[model samples]
Target: MTEFLPPWPLLTAFVLASLALAITPGPAVVYIVTRTLAQGRQAGLASIGAVALGNLGNAIGASLGLAVLFSVSALAFSVVKYAGAAYLIWLGIRALRGGAAAADGGTVEAAPRSLRQVVRDGFVVALLNPKTAIFFAAFLPQFMNPAGSALTQSLALGVAFVLIAATTDACYVMAAAAVMPALRRAGRARALGRYLTGAAFIGLGVFTAASGSRAAK
Candidate 1:
């Protein structure tokens, strides 16, 4: 296992970089925290697991040359990018509509989703983001051992990054879950939370779409 990894110094750098990246909140973190705020710890955990799996899939895809396709083919990247952005926007609209309905009916929150649905949503959210695969392809190579097998090293490093990210993501879920009760205690705040969540989703979608346009240039 050690033989398959980069040199000690490089490995340390990779670990540090991974930790920094993981600790910083991204789209995945936002989605997980939103789930925690809306549902509970269980749903947040499920989202984390599903998103981790999806990220692992992206890593594997990067290892298998999918990232190469995205790098060389703007069309391929755009298709996936738009699809993901559309999905996120749709989720936001649905959340907004749900919140509106709840407000009209004097409810505090939107309809709760099942664990399975939450998992599916999280998985799709991660998997649809082409940027993750592209990022892995670009980021993992910098730490790879030139003497070792590229595929093996990429897989190992990708998995390591995912694990680190999942650990950090779990921390975010815990933190969000802790504050959920306070949000729920206030009737207006609880109702307002749904709109905020919806807006966050929309903002992420717009950011994603805009990033793709910039990348194309």
Candidate 2:
């Protein structure tokens, strides 16, 4: 309803905006970077897959007017926000303690988790973010084509945003992985990675805790 027109005409601008947003640093980006740095590209991709799906769920929910619940219900928002913040901090602490090592200068190859569990962890990380719903609510409307079905337009834009994010995030992950061999060859990076990733997660949690309702991206 906000100057929305035919999608074809608006598509280019939407893509540009989405790219800009995707490139801008956020919790999702930080998470991907941390995962890649802590493990490898594959782990980063796994986390991204879950995050994307979780975001897709939020986008669909936003298209369905779920933000209204957050808008009108402070308790709901606070509960979700706090929960997500706590979970991130917990994960950070766990990473700090474990550091994903086997105490013999080797990675944790023995830790075998099903893809389903990985997906679930990622989904929960995303689902706990109330701000993402708020973000979709506020951000998508600007590019929406009111001439078309508003819900459909929102959904389409949301998917596009997710795709853009994944592409950009993949680039970053790959770059981080590309450097792994160098870091490994140098040795003494295990503790560094543990502190860096743990701090990032904790920082993200703090940022989430401080976020306000209706704050734009």
Instruction: Please tell me which predicted candidate would have the highest lDDT against the true structure.
Output: 1
What stretches of model 1 exceed 4 Å from their correct place?
Answer: 1-3, 106-112, 213-217
Model 1 lDDT per residue over 1-217, tens place: 6548898899999999999988887778888898888888999999999999889998999999999998899999999998989988888887888899886885534534688988988898888888999899889999988888899989999999999998998999999999989888987876687788789888888988888522200
**C-alpha lDDT score of every prediction, in listed order:** 0.85, 0.78
Per-residue CA lDDT of model 2 for 36-152, tens digit only, reads: 777777878888898998888888889898887987899999999899889888777766665655455656432124556556666788878878888899888887776677877
What TM-score would each prediction reach against the true structure?
0.92, 0.87
RMSD of each: 2.8, 3.5
TM-score of 2: 0.87
What is candidate 2's CA lDDT for residue 199? 85
